[model samples]
Target: MSDDEGAGRRPKKQRPFWQELPVLIVIAAVIAALMVNFIGRPYVIPSQSMEPTLHGCTGCTGDRIYVQKLSYYWSDPKPGDVVVFVGPPSWNDTYRSNRSSNTLVRGVQNFFSYFGLVPPDENDLVKRVIAVGGQTVECCDAQGRILVDGKPLDEPYVQKDYPWVAGQNAAYPRGRVFAPIKVPAGHLWVMGDNRNESRDSRAHTSDELHGTVPVDNVRGKAVFKIWPPGRMGPVRSHDPQSN
Candidate 1:
């Protein structure tokens, strides 16, 4: 057939945008998933545990943070690094689901969580690392300070300490008193800046691991606060031990 006859028989037809939209969406989703799983992910602070460092208040918009997963592959978590981790089994003993009870609503929330729109359904928590493997940690020297390796930590970040009510709990009558615990290797003892309000390692010392979280359970290091225009800044990672 002649060139003109052949061209006329094979007319170019552009596909409608509606037909291409799904392909584009699927591609975008795949890229987002890879980044969230391997590179880093966003997390919303769920409580006042890390107050002053990361804010989370009930009935209010919590600070959204960017957690870097790449760093831990080369370096283990250090003291004072704010981290997000899966709670130890004992930590979640009274945990309750936050997702809607409706099946369809829960399913929808799960789908958005993959893209970091909603928080994960698991019992994930955030706290500052106070002591690492092999360190002896305890609370309340005469001046009321946390000790690591027998050195009192000068923690200026702890602005609010929960007060000890007289006769509340005999074991912790001084509010932050705990017997010196030699942290097990490969675990971390973490706490919150809001000392009194936080339920941290000190609260779970009776557990099998003695309230220490395994390093493997840490998801990532919280590097920056990305939500709430007024609170956008790097999450503080002060090494209290250095002082």
Candidate 2:
């Protein structure tokens, strides 16, 4: 063929849609998986872990928080982050295995609860952050004072009626000072606003562990309640050290 004829001839075009179909589908699947894993996740409050701060209605109904999985990307778990984390060692009955069959079923129930498929359960306790790591969180003083880092923690989240007393227990005693731990490098000392009822770091990790929680265990901070229209509000970081 002459060079002029060759130049005039057009090259056959390669079909792209079919050739790229498999790769495109794989990419799409990966994106979907990432979204489900990180972007937005659904969780059910299965027990009275947090109270007052959040309440459950039934075997299915309760308050919901849209956890910002990426929120911590720019920051670390702060002192006042109302967080949803998997429980560690269980000394009291309040601890629930996040992976157990019961909780798994609860997750499924929560999926349908939004559509009125089931009643919301009050098992999940929605409480405020009382004390963070490194700070000294004491119950009550001689008169009545809850101190954090030698300064009193003005806890308005505690049950309005049941007032907080220092070392109320004879063993611990009222007005007793709870020593402060440096919070370690990656640990946290979490407490429920409902001090008396919450079996948090104060009880479980005390003595042996001194209520200090490892930072790695934290899942995400409770930023907002997305369920039940009545209790809608933003979850602020009460911890001053969450810096």
Best by TM-score: 1
- The ten-residue window of minimal lDDT in model 2 covers 119-128
lDDT of 1 by residue, 138-243 (tens): 8756566789999999788988885545554465533378889999999999999988689889889998999999999999999999989999999989998998
Tens digit per residue, CA lDDT, model 2, 64-133: 6766578766766765677766555453255333332687787877654444335433232333445555
Give the runs in model 1 whose Cα sits over 4 Å from its true position: 1-14, 102-105, 162-175
Candidate that would win on lDDT: 1
Provide the clash count, candidate 1.
1
Q: Model 2 segments beyond 4 Å from truth?
A: 1-29, 57-60, 90-133, 160-182, 239-243
State in Å the error of residue 64, model 1: 1.3
Q: Each prediction's Cα lDDT score?
A: 0.88, 0.57
